[model samples]
Target: MIEMIEIAPKVLGLRINGKINEEDMEKMLSVCKAKMKDEERIAVYVEVEEIGGISFNALIEDLKFALPNLKRFSKKAVVSDIKWHEPLIKVGDKLFPSIEVRHYNQDQRAEALKWVQE
Candidate 1:
């Protein structure tokens, strides 16, 4: 399941857990686009917990949505217990120099949120 967490004017905070389907991805994309319409540059905070899996269609949608909107994001904070995600985010930081990407363990969720809002 994927749902919106906090709704700051220029920030998008989400909590994603369990399996993610196309509907979930579509809803997230819709909300993101709507938020982007109001704010030029937004900060994103994502908290992932016990992820079962993600559908291929959702993954494809994510790629399609992310590529074009990369420039619209100022900062992204990902909080997850998944160890591999940290390194992947680091790679993304290197690849997308314009956007600041950071990863935190599940325990540091509050810190992640604070940093993203800053």
Candidate 2:
């Protein structure tokens, strides 16, 4: 499941769990684009609590569409218990230097929010 909330004017709080597929990817992208339409700067707090897994094609499509938006966001905080996500986010940081991607433990949700708000 994927859920999103607008925490601030240009900040979005997103949570993802369970198995993500192509349909979920499409919905997520639509939500993000709609939220960011009039905002020049955005911040995202992405929480991955129990992601069963993601489809390979869906993951690729997500990256293709979302990576460019990272440059438009001021900061992005990814909270996850998944080990592989850290390195993946680090790579994303390199790809979009304008946006800061910080990974946090699942328990550190509040801290992640604070970091992005900073």
lDDT for 6 (candidate 2) = 61
| Tens-place lDDT digits, model 2, residues 1-118 | 7777567767778888898888888887787787789787878888988877889978998889777666678999999989999999999899888888899997898898888887
Residue-pair clashes per candidate: 0, 0
Worst-scoring 10-residue span by lDDT in model 2: 1-10
Off by over 4 Å in 2: none
| RMSD of model 2 against the true structure | 2.2
RMSD, model 1, all Cα superposed? 1.4
Q: Tell me which residue pairs clash in candidate 1.
A: none
True lDDT of residue 80, candidate 2: 91
Candidate 2 global CA lDDT score: 0.83
Q: What is the TM-score of each candidate against the true structure?
A: 0.90, 0.80
